[model samples]
Target: MARPRKPLLSRERIVDTARALVDAEGLAAVSTRRLAAELGVSGPSLYNHFRTKDQILEAVADSVSAQVDLSMFDAADPRDWRTALHDWAVSYRAALTLHPNIVPVLARGPGRRPAGLRLADAVFGAMVAAGWPPAQATSIGALMRYFIMGSALGSFAGGFVDDETAYDPADYPHLGQAHLLAERQDLIDARAFETGLHALLDGLAAQYEHMAGGEGPGRPAGDASTPAEASPGHP
Candidate 1:
């Protein structure tokens, strides 16, 4: 019997390898030639699976988005909405942080991909299910998505200093003091993420309540909380 030849390359394999490459060496290192070399194939072989680096990047982003467990969020409990959002935000931050180099690509173009759109829909659906109107739910969901992506991109680009290194008592006395008190026991990896997510959900909930004819506790009458208000002491 004639021997069967194995498939030379597949889109899944290409995207997986591309993701690993970006995770290891940043997005700059992901090229068809480099990927082919890593996969023990000829450079032109990669074109059979992905026509260009952008396509490969898109594929990689899709793969990553697929890994997000949308079911982890709870849409039934209004009180638990903040916690659910926190979990989702934390998971998203961790995923992007692990591959910081991909943050730019993710921010720039992945928003329209099927997985990305589906994730957005899921978030919006969750919000609506939790009693928010369609427009408010959509706006809040988009706002949270933007916040998470922007924060991750900023963190990847060194816009954010590590909590340990960011504090300087001489220049930032109050911030330094607060950091010291907050991290005295343990410094959580995604404290900022959790804090931001909670603030966003809290603000959204307040808005929803107000729109539904209830006076909310978090914000003043007729004024929504801004991002600055959401992140009171954050830079």
Candidate 2:
């Protein structure tokens, strides 16, 4: 039957299967032999799609980047770029968190990677359109990557020891109250992410206002986003 249609494997399938393998186990779990067995194809057949395991990993990382939501920043009005970028960053980090095994690999660089380049282009392009200097936009992109990768690699506040005896007041009084943090571990990390994100955005807004020479971060006369959403108290 036409040689079984070349065993029905594409680069997409290989990348997807490789990603699942990485997620289920670890990066080391992915191999041509293992992948071929999982895909029901011979080991040598995988070479037709990817030349090396590292190549498969690069493709998998790009696939993950491809899932980040960029719709918020793709709107006609660009004033919401700060908020839009914040939302996008949240989605990006969430996606990276899913595949923490690949986060370190992704940090290797975005050279020749379609999904990573697409993500970078979208963020950088939106910032430039929003009146940010090219240099500033580039710096913002780099900063975002740093923040996102760090978040993926580790927790902001580790769960505290709940046992009271673990803390000897004579040695450290503060340790006794540490148990409260265990209850709010997720809240603490989320708030810290938001706080840092907003601080960065606030600084960027100031720069944009100065560079635009306009009515600060608010809309001048008629604009979408900030103007429509700006309240008397906020303005």
How many clashes in each candidate? 0, 0
- Among these predictions, the greatest lDDT belongs to 2
The CA lDDT of each predicted structure is: 0.66, 0.77
Model 1, C-alpha of 105: deviation from truth (Å): 1.3
Where is the poorest 10-residue window by lDDT in model 2?
226-235
Q: Tens-digit lDDT track for model 1 on 122-192?
A: 77667656665555555566577688777676432233343655777788776643434443322343556
Point to the candidate with the largest TM-score.
Answer: 2
- Each candidate structure's TM-score, on Cα atoms with residue i matched to residue i, is 0.72, 0.79
RMSD of each: 7.0, 8.4
Model 2 C-alpha lDDT versus the unseen true structure: 0.77
